[model samples]
Target: MTDRQWADWHRPQQHYLIEPRYLAGGGDIRHATEFLRASGWKDRSKTGGPLVFHNPDKLVRVVFDPLAQPGGWTVEGRATADRPSWEARFGTGTPVEIIAGLTDALTQQPTAHAPNVWAPLGTHGWEARRGQHVTAVSPDKSAFVQFHQSSPGQAHWWIGARTEHGRAWDAHLSPTTPLSLVQALTTALSDPRPVMRPLGNVPPSDRIRSTSVSVTPAQLGAWQQARLTAARTAMWARSAWTAARPRNRHPATAAPRVPAGHTTGRR
Candidate 1:
C-alpha cells in the first residue's frame, strides 16, 4: 500500500449504502478508490463493487459532489451560486468551500473523481422552485432525477445517504456524512439559489457515505452460488409443497381438525 493509502487506512468512518447504478459513472468504486488512494484512503472491506473507503482516523471525509442535476431535480442559482447559502446564512458556507478548506487539513488525492460524473442539476422545462418538490408532469417520465437504490425500488435524493464509508461489522451500516447538499429543489421557474429543500422530510447529511472494499474471485463465486442455491431450493420447495396437496381442493380450506361442538349420535 502507498503512504496515502496507509494514512487513509487508519482513519475513522461512517457507513452508507450506495446504488449500483449511481456508482456507474463518477460515483463508481474504481473512480472513488482512485481519488481516495491519492489522498491516503484505502479500500478496507472484502466486498467489491461498493463505494466504501476508509481513512486512518477521521482524517478526511470523502464527499460525493454531484455536478449535474438529474432530470426533475433543480438547483437555485443565487442560492447555489456561491457556496450553498445555508452554510452562509446558517454560517457554515457552501460544501465546495468547506471541502476546499478541509483539503489543507489532510492529503488531497489527485484522481479522476469529478462532479461531471453526477449529472448536473437541471430544471428540465419545469419551473424551478426553491424549497419545494418538483412537479412530475408525467407519471412515467423518461428522465429520472437522481435515484438511490432502496430495498423495494429506486428512490430520489432522500435515499442518497446510503453511501457511507466505514467498517463491515454491521453488515452495511456506518457513521458517515455527505460532502455536499445534493437535495431536491422546487420545480417552479423562479427558484432561489440556496436550493433549499421544501419537503417535510429530507435525507440527513449523516446518511450519505462511502464504504468501498476489495472483492475476491472466490468470494464472488461463493456469494453467487449461495444466492443461486437458495433461490433454487425455494423454487423446488414451493413446487413440491403445491404438488403434494389435493389438486381440486380450495387453497383457503385447510385440513379439518378434530370435530368440535358435535354430540355423539348414540346415547
Candidate 2:
C-alpha cells in the first residue's frame, strides 16, 4: 500500500467467503484459485490451489471477466481499468445463511445489501483481511457470487451490482500467487476517493411526507363552473379564428429548409 497521508482505506476491515464444495474430502485448492483468477483475483502465497486469494483490485477483475477453465476460476488482470467491484450473488438460497458462513469462516462481521447483495468493505478495491482462512464447500444448489470490475465511462460497477452464471465462472488457470494484485490494490486503496451513494434508488427520506391533495366539493363545483364558462366563450370565437387559420396541408409544410448561404422565395 502507498502509505500516503492523503490515501483513504477502511481500518480493521475483514471479508470472507464460504464455499462448501471447497471443504470436501476430494477438494483441490489450486483448482479454486484457477477459477477465481480468470475473473481477476490472484494469490501471493502460491498455496497450491483454492486456498485464499484476497485483494480488492484483483478480486474485481476476476469477478466480472473470470477466466473459466474446465475446473476452477483463474487470476488474470486486476480489474483496475474496469471499475472493479464484487457481488455476493446467491442461487435461490438464504442470504443470511450464506453471509453467516463467510462470517464464521473468516471471523468477521458479515452484512447484507438485500437478498444477494452482501455487506460492503474497502474503498476502491481494498479488503481488510483477518481471521484464519478456511475451505468453502459448494452447495448442491450452487450460490455463485462474483466480484467484477466495470468498464471505462461506465462507473456502474462501483455504484451498482453484478451477477455470474454457470460455466462463465468455473474457469481455471495454472497455480499462481496473487502477490502483485494485492500490492497494486494496497497502493490504490491507500489514497481513497470515497463516494457514498445508495446502491439503487436513493430511498425517499423519512422526513418527507406526501402532501395532502385539496379535493373539496366546493372546489370541484367552482372548477366545473369555470370550465363551462370558458368553453362557451371559446365556442363563440372559434368560427372567426378558423376563417383565417392556415391548413395542415398547406404548400409551405413541404418546403425544404434553405441553404445557409442562399435566399429563397424572393428570387
Candidate 3:
C-alpha cells in the first residue's frame, strides 16, 4: 500500500485529521436531523414513510426520504396553508454538513449584514454573471450555482459540484427559498479553507479536481497522540466527577417506561 494509504489505515476513525476540498462527499443525515430535534422541531413522521419534522409554529416543515427521487430531503416555509413562502430541496448525495448549514440558519435570527452569495465566488476568481439569470462558476469550472426564472412567476435556483466522472452534490431552491439559506450554502461553497480527507479514501474523480497537500508522518503522529492524551484526560476527569457525586440513600420509584414502537402520524 502507498505511504498515505498506510497512514489512513492506522488513523483512528474519529480523529480530527482532514484535508481541505471544495466539495466534500455525502455525509450521514443524522447530524442534520438531530440538530433539528434539539432545536425544538417536532418529529411528525409516520411509521412506513418519510421522516418529517415541523417547527413549533407549524409554519416550517422538513421532510427526509431515503427512497425519494431528485430530492430526498426538502424544507418548506409557508406564511399560510394557501400561500407558500419558500422552499428548498436537497438531493440524496448532498452532504449532511452542508444541509446543516441551512438548518442552522433557519433556527437563528437573521443578521443585518447577510452573506453575499455571488461576491465570495467572484473574490475567489470564480466567474459570475447577471442578466436574465444569475450564475457563478468555480475557478476550475467544476462547480456552479445558477438562479433563473423557470417560468413566469416561478423562480429556480441550482447549485452543484462535480468532476469529470460525475456530480459530487447539488441542491435546488424555489423562488421563495430564503436568501439567508442560499447565503449559507454559498458561504460553505466559497470557503477558502480545505476539508481534510484521507488521500486513499478520496474518489478518483475528486482527486483530479483537488490539490493534495502532504502532511508528514511525524505531524500526523503528533496530532493523533495529542488527541489520545486529551481524550484520556477528559475520561479520567469524568470518572472522578462521577465517583465524587453523592448518591441518594432512598431513590424514588421510576415512572413506567413506554415500549418502543413506531406510531402513525399525519404530516
> TM-score order of candidates, best first?
3, 1, 2
Candidate 1 structure quality by residue, lDDT tens digits, 1-267? 887765565543432332222221121222223433444455553443223344444433343323222211111112222222111110111222222222222232222232111222233332122122222211112122222224443223321112244211101111111122221111211121221111221223343233344444344446546644544454456456657863221012111111222221210
lDDT of 3 by residue, 1-267 (tens): 898888775655422222224455555466577666755678999999999999766888989997866657898887554344777888776656677778756655455563455665666666765555667777677777787656776668888877677877778887556565677777767666645455554555634345555665556567656644544454456456658874211111121111223221211
Native-referenced Cα lDDT, model 1: 0.27
lDDT of 2 by residue, 1-267 (tens): 666422333222221222221111112222223333332334454334333455323332222111223322222333333223223321111222222232122111112211111111222222222112111111232222122213432211111111232221221111121222222222221222221111231222332122223243344346545644544454445445546763121011111111232221210
Using lDDT as the measure, what is the rank order of every candidate, best first?
3, 1, 2
lDDT of each: 0.27, 0.25, 0.63
TM-score of 3: 0.64
Residue 158 lDDT, candidate 2, scale 0-100: 13
Model 1 / residue 107 / CA error / Å: 8.2
lDDT of 3: 0.63
Badly placed stretches (over 4 Å) of model 1 are 1-28, 47-51, 59-120, 123-141, 144-156, 159-267
